[model samples]
Target: MFGSIWQYVYTNFLRYWLKWFIRQVTGKCELQRICSDYTPGASRTTRAENSLQASKNKVLRGALKTSRDHVEQCVDQIMKAKNIKPQKDPLFKGSLHICLLQITGYSSLYTSVEELRKEVFSSENPEHEAMLLKLWGLLMPEVKLECRITKQWGDIGFQGDDPKTDFRGMGLLGLINLVFFSENYTAEARQVLSHANHPKLGYSYAIVGINLTEMAYSLLKCGALKPHFYNTVQGTPELKHFHQLYCYLAYEFDQFWVAEQPESIMLFNQYREKFHDKVKTHLQDPDVSLTLTVGSY
Candidate 1:
């Protein structure tokens, strides 16, 4: 037992030390490697040694950003890419699958694709409540919650006076959170509005339906929403790969993670490509600024 405890402690302690070491070394302004802006694989300079120490893994910085900004940028980029009007083609049925493909490191299993459709999406499965609990653990991981086995509380998702509400998936109104909690909780992310109230966050028949009128109005303003919705999923592997990225963006919007992605020349170059002439002509654009920092977490 002592040995096990020692191993556990050693692993966590080492990881903590590793984070510090990476921050200490690369925190300097000299080597400006962007994109993979991280506190890992950092090297310390030594005079006599004439070499820098190395870290095992590297982190990419600046992954998250303000939602409003993200929405606008996404709109601009999508528009600039092409005038391709987004239509709800049957081919792209599983939009989540495409989004999930991008989310590699992040995983919220309780709401896995299967579970999402079954419990959260279709919500026919009586065990959906249990699944929601599991997903909450993965996404929020900060809110402490208790799972009551009995339906004494009535249907899953929504928790309120209305028993008529099957409340399959609540979205913004503390729906997913009816599940579990984690140590790395960012409470500000909590949504006061109900996602079940929005069609974009559609769950099941028992849940609320998205209002087409409001969605159409939103589409004109936010073009990214169309592309996001058009995705159903052509291939499994490729779609799932991107879903992770999509989900991460949907869920996590922390300032700290942004300053930690790979921002190396190569990476930035790609970003530049994505940003196009914005970097070429107006690199000094007002929006441009150094993002990575410590303790923003």
Candidate 2:
């Protein structure tokens, strides 16, 4: 009896005291407000429920000034005190809280994408060469290509002979997204590649895929995809989540192209712009999913 009482009291002490500690260190006014609103004598369940709701309201109102990392740490501390799982916790799983985390996650992801954009993919880097080969192998498992950087790159999807020149704009990020999609969903990736090679409506597969990466990045930056991210993701998003978004765009755009029935690849930009506008409109809704329903096409 005494142990249980002591444990409960100690848990509350930590939860209540940490708010003041956070306020003094971070100077986040919203945390101060949340801490001050705690009602003493409330049951532990009630306290947790109230705190989670208050945090969500603050997040939605744009009143929370605390950084995502700090908030995440706070949640960790609370969960440890309460002996609860993170994903099962009400605070982190709430839509508004996830929305805030998504914002922070997107900022970090965009910075990474920007850094990758600046780096020119080089064959000298063993990792880059390995990834390039892995990408080709994942897409064309049956046909083996030479290890040397040569025109054989065209056998997959590069514009010219050497695939290295093709990474000028999107750089390593584009290649990584392409590789991620192919490695995770080989069949769907091959189908998309086949569509890109259509006799009449054929487009440059790698080039179009990279362009879609730019589009995905742009949507994330402008907050157009917030609705989708906020609702679908129950916790902090990650780089793989961004890559997944790119995969969706790459796959869906191929379907869009084939459906549009354009006369030739010459009309790509026109159809591409149309598809972009459609995505923007979908994002305008507060409940957009934008999930890729890939199948064995």
TM-score against truth, every candidate: 0.22, 0.70
RMSD, every candidate, angstroms: 24.4, 12.7
Tens digit of lDDT per residue, candidate 1, span 230-291?
22222222323223222232233222123334333234334323333322232233222221
Best model per lDDT: 2
Q: Show where candidate 2 strays beyond 4 Å.
A: 1-66, 72-99, 295-297
Quantify all predictions' global Cα lDDT against the true fold.
Answer: 0.29, 0.68
The residue pairs that clash in candidate 2, if any, are: none
Q: What number of clashing residue pairs does each candidate have, in the order they appear?
A: 48, 0
How big is the positional error of residue 82 in model 2, measured in Å on the Cα after superposition?
A: 23
Question: Top TM-score: which candidate number?
Answer: 2
Output the lDDT of residue 171, model 1: 27
